[model samples]
Target: VLPHDPSMRPVWMMRIGLFLYDHLARREVLPASATVDLRHGEIGQPLKPRYSKGFAYSDGWVDDARLVVLNAVDARERGAEVLTRWRCADAQRAASGWQVTLQGPGGQERSVQAKVLVNAAGPWAAQFLREHAHIQDSKTLRLVKGSHIVVRKLFDHQTAYVLQSPDRRIIFVIPYEGEFTLIGTTDVEHNGPVGQARIAADEIAYLCEQASRYMRQTVTPADVVWSYSGVRPLLEDEAANPAAVTRDYQLELDTRAAPLLTVWGGKMTTFRKLAEEAADMLAAPLGGSRGAWTQDAFLPGGDLSGWIGTAQRPDGDFQRFEQALTLRHPELSEPMARRWARAYGSRVELLLRDGLGEVVAPGLYEAELRYLHEHEWARTADDVLWRR
Candidate 1:
């Protein structure tokens, strides 16, 4: 955390939280937090001289879109039909189960009878219940738009900086795509449609101004190359501030007729646990097993066969895996090979099994595009560029 004007509560509170966190959990992957002299090292070099003292902490990052795609792939491999670009237009209680009308692209619709219905839509959970299922929900969703901006690389080091703004909020400046710095996120109240979320001009200026406070290099709105925003469906707790709203989720099961599970206000970090609990809740009603099978299971493309490092130290394993991937595909460029290995993990072999086909773009090839379309349900150019 960065140093601010007068109050040190944020820093001290962070230290105390880190202390409790280090003692509370089995921290085998990342190291514990510590006090650091930012003036002496690369971490401090990027910041202004006035901001000399700070705290350092560790956290892991994940490709969220890739994680969702991999989960779908794992489910499809386990005999679950994974459909993309499909929506539940209508859901009604049938004699045996739920009579759901699924609408697809080109205005085509299909009907399916599901024993149990799960409304796991992120921001549209309440809307789905009200509009499609014709059920009114008592709970409210406070839509908060979190915006982020990407700019040219700021610091040379790989360490991410968590800057405390004058408003007491924190923004992260992390390395992105090996060429840019990803900075974000503003939690502003959003009243527009969920899918229409876009980074506002003011949000961009705010991020740039906040980030420029500490960094030696001032961040300006002109420096931002790209920006995006997502509306968070947070559980409304009547908090006066949008940022103060709770992120925890609630699972509501309506067994009035057929079982309908409505998942409300959850972040991606606790998705697995939420899914497990949701499954367990519906297990008895659906006559399915109640075992927590996903607790020890690996997501698709997560297994590294020749891994030499434990869960605590997995960096070396991936480095070695990348090396092996490069060795196998000597014809591929080092950057391309490493990107594929990082993106697909051990499943890179499956991606390259058919051999690299025609070059579709500068770095993108036809084989990878085909694999994404066939396996990851990628259809549009935006899907390929932004998602897979």
Candidate 2:
């Protein structure tokens, strides 16, 4: 789920929440809501809204929180070779020239002769070396489990709340998409594969209890619409509380056998920075052709000539730039169009390739699909539905 701020939450959560509040909210800012009711009715907090509902946009709008799909989509865009279900490196040394052993779509096999190689397989970073690279005594990475609970929207206001749980862990009541409030994030030690992770029932109860403090409504397991769990591969730190563990990333390089770089403790929001660093390290060994350049560069659709739209002051001087994109392109509704604008930034104009012409398609088109398919390696429809 997205967070209202990044002071405590992971960087990725902040990015998603910032994007949502920027384009979706009519007021352009999330207003704080005060609770008036805290009682739990017979069936507990009402399961569904009793009255009719209205929407700012149609159902199934894009920009939902689905990081897995978004990452896959981005990996494809950056021309990175991605393997879905891959095997361990097995501690074997890669041969000199570029080697390619095609197994199946489920696995990946490639050889690299770089001055540096990055191992960012989440929990499997240590295991990759233990099994494949013949590197003895690999550093430890303490795994942590973070879980979230999804429930019906808790407030009429468009803003999300970043509440402090009793345990001092933070929980967010974000306006997820349009229908539900996404809450969660409890960090505990993990001892299993990240893929096998699942949210525990107690975690749900804990989240509900914590949320009940700031909210007027009482949430429970029954009120939960959905839940998710993920494993964070954190740098081994002896901190007492998992919540207090450092969120910064660390890198280790071993030039003994071949160059082996292992990554630990990183989040989705910082992936861009991580990737650029990895590229710079690998470039020297792979033949340095380009210098480091990413911080200021815009992502796929983020290029803007000026900061979006401008407003005039009483004296006709420019004062502010509000989102009036819908005024120009009537094809997209305010929210969806704005989603494209913020997520893609100035790049939204590229989606309007025809330029001031009618929109031939409502949602996605063939050109877009082909671009994702060829450049982005989008194997499923969810990649576009969730990430694009």
Candidate 3:
């Protein structure tokens, strides 16, 4: 934890702090102005955690589109038809269930019949209800905006800083994309179209100013390499503060007329659990459920098992798995081997196909791009870079 005032060090924890430098390097004690000395002209202070040890950090970043694509792929592998680029024009009540009109790309319309209707359209769930009446529209969505800025690397160390601003909001300055620092997150009510969500100038300035107060180097708007904003679909709680709003999700099952399920406001962290609960709710009415099976199930491309180690230097069977991969392939490069260990896990053979096949870019291969296009639904350059 980074305290704004140097005197806060003694206030938070009296037992002198440890500034974690790396996996094997944790400098002990404090000489008062450690931030100024360690970070060189930074204006923040670090203190020892009340209960030391068990401090961890992850460098995991999910490609949002890839996550969706992979889930769909997994579903398809488990025998489910997935149709993308299809828009639900309307859903009319039918004798048995619902007659959903799906408009596909290149001017084609199809009908999909479902016994139960589930609205998981994120921020557009309520709007979808209004335009396409599947049930009595009573649910509301609280659109909260969250923005993040990627800038040139601020700190040399892997340990990220959680900065508390004067406004009482905390922002994170974490290493991003290897050569950049990712700083974020302002919670404000959003009114615009969710598709048009973008970082506001004030938000960028706020992030920059807040980060600059702690980082050794001063960061300005021009220093920002890229910025993005996402609208969080929160449940309408009538909360005065957007940040104060609940992140918990609410599932409404209206079985009066038919089985109409409305998914409102869910945190990504508990998505799997929420999904299992949702399945249980919908299943009992339809026929029956298999109960919660995902607890023991492994996601596609993720089957490796072992105890997790320190964040910086993770110790697991992953290393042995990679060694096995190298032994099997015999031609997979060091960096590609590591990438395979992370990205594909045990399913790397499906990716290597013939070989990592013709370098299209650093750490990216032509075969991978083709595979992404053929399987992962990557259509454009942005889809390949930003999505997949």
**The candidate that achieves the highest TM-score relative to the unseen native structure:** 1
TM-score of 1: 0.96
Candidate 2 minimal-lDDT segment of 10 residues:
51-60
Candidate 3 clashing pairs? none
- Which of the predicted structures, 2 or 3, would earn the higher TM-score when compared with the native? 3
Off by over 4 Å in 2: 1-91, 94-102, 106-115, 269-291, 306-328, 346-375, 386-388
Task: Give per-model TM-scores.
Answer: 0.96, 0.67, 0.82
Model 2 C-alpha lDDT per residue in residues 1-388, reported as the tens digit of each score:
2112223455455446555755675442233222222133222132222211111111212343433545554566778667654544444445542222334555656543434456777777777666655455546778889999999888655545556454556676667766788887888788877689899988998999877755657887899989988888887778888777778887665556556667777876677788777776666556765876766554454334364434223112111121545666676766566455545545455556644344325656564565555544567877666545
Assess each prediction's global lDDT (C-alpha) against the native: 0.87, 0.59, 0.73
Model 1, 310-388: lDDT tens per residue? 4434787788878878787897899898889878887877778889999998899988998898889999899998898
TM-score of candidate 3 against the unseen true structure = 0.82
User: For candidate 3, lDDT tens digit of each residue in 14-37?
Assistant: 223333333334323212223322
Best by lDDT: 1
Error of 3 at 77 (Å): 1.1
